[model samples]
Target: MDREIAYGAIGARLETKLNETGLSRNEQAESLGISRSALATYISLERIPSASTVARAVDRFDIDPRWLLTGDERDRITRDQWVAVLSAFVELKAIMDRLFKDRIGWHQASHDDRMKVYRAGETLYEIGGISALNACANALYEGNPGAQLGAGDMLNHLFNGIGPWRA
Candidate 1:
């Protein structure tokens, strides 16, 4: 099978595990050191995760890389992974809304809705602001300075336990 297709299947399978374990795609990706977009694609069965990605799943979620890749959710995401995802979401939110006001517009529905779904807590500021702010966090986290998620194993923990919650 094609790599993308494989990744997509794994991604879809990963999502199944996430929902069973009550995790969000954004949260799961961060814990595994992958981008949120990558996770989203995986969940929709549109993309596949790399080897390192699988390793991250093993290290963070404790779901056994072999099984996770092969479409098994017999295991659950570790408590440690859960904490990591939550921290990432909190850290990202703080930066976008409070620290970086100049970068966002602060709109509704599209932006905030996604934010609430992915990041969790306190209704989103607005769509424009949410996206801009989240993009800032994304670029900053995996790129430049102020990468709050930190560099290490179990990076996906940065986004765990969050969902489209009312603020």
Candidate 2:
């Protein structure tokens, strides 16, 4: 996943909020004491803006930080956490895409091979299983929603013998 693209999307959302408030980038820069170019970068999501900068923009325009960071002010996630997760999820999705490809590949399509792919996909999705069967079951039950877990959990599940204790 390209972190830069994610950051840029957030910046564009922030710029949208400012536009709706009738506030220009120059004004926001002057008021926040940040460089206009920096503010522009924030608008472009080219750079991850600080929490304080987000707060200032929110306070100044009476907007919400969550909205600026995630394009959804109503989302409950914090600004920084959302940014990190957004990048992480983008990467996770890429991993999952590979897994999907493997699932269809001839080598991994046979009974044993498909099972292997499924077992490995389980680790990527964080359902540490004692064996291929166990992992396959978990992957089925948990469905794709479980894929939201972080890479650490996925790695642990994939490599570490079952759960944390078993490992």
Candidate 3:
């Protein structure tokens, strides 16, 4: 199979497992010890899951790794499922927009910088769902420079992987 097809199969299987668990995306990410963005990337077939992530998914979700890599006919994503996933991504984009709205320099920031912020927000969402993301945004929106500096520093550390905090 082609690499992209394999990844799509794996992503579909992962999405199947996620649906089986009936957990929210944030809860699923927390259980898998990955950022929500990582999960999204996997589901969107933008990236393959790492070995460790696959292992964790196999163990945590009782999924057969082989089946995950090459899903059978039963595992295919239906049109409704695909639509639902696209809808979720749209909602996520809306959330990201809200996260950056009214923030200084957000409009002027480069695309890369915007992506960094989106990634940071996704990490925060994994940590504490929407509330955590909201807190980060609130911190930035607060007129206090110190709070904004702290939030900015936290986001920078998260994006660069140069901090004591793991998440």
Best by the TM-score measure: 3
List model 1 lDDT by residue over 42-72, tens digit each.
6776544544465467566555443454433
> Cα deviation in Å at residue 86, candidate 3?
33
Model 1 earns a TM-score of: 0.36
Model 1 / residue 147 / CA error / Å:
32
lDDT of 3 by residue, 31-64 (tens): 8999999899889877666545765786687775
Sorted on lDDT, highest at the top, how do the candidates line up? 3, 2, 1
Off by over 4 Å in 3: 1-5, 72-167
Clashing pairs in 2: 7-45, 8-45, 11-43
User: lDDT of each structure?
Assistant: 0.44, 0.47, 0.54
Order of all candidates by TM-score, from best down to worst?
3, 2, 1
TM-score of each: 0.36, 0.39, 0.40
Which scores better on TM-score, 1 or 2? 2
Alpha-carbon shift of residue 83 in model 1 (angstroms): 24
Better of 2 and 3 by TM-score: 3
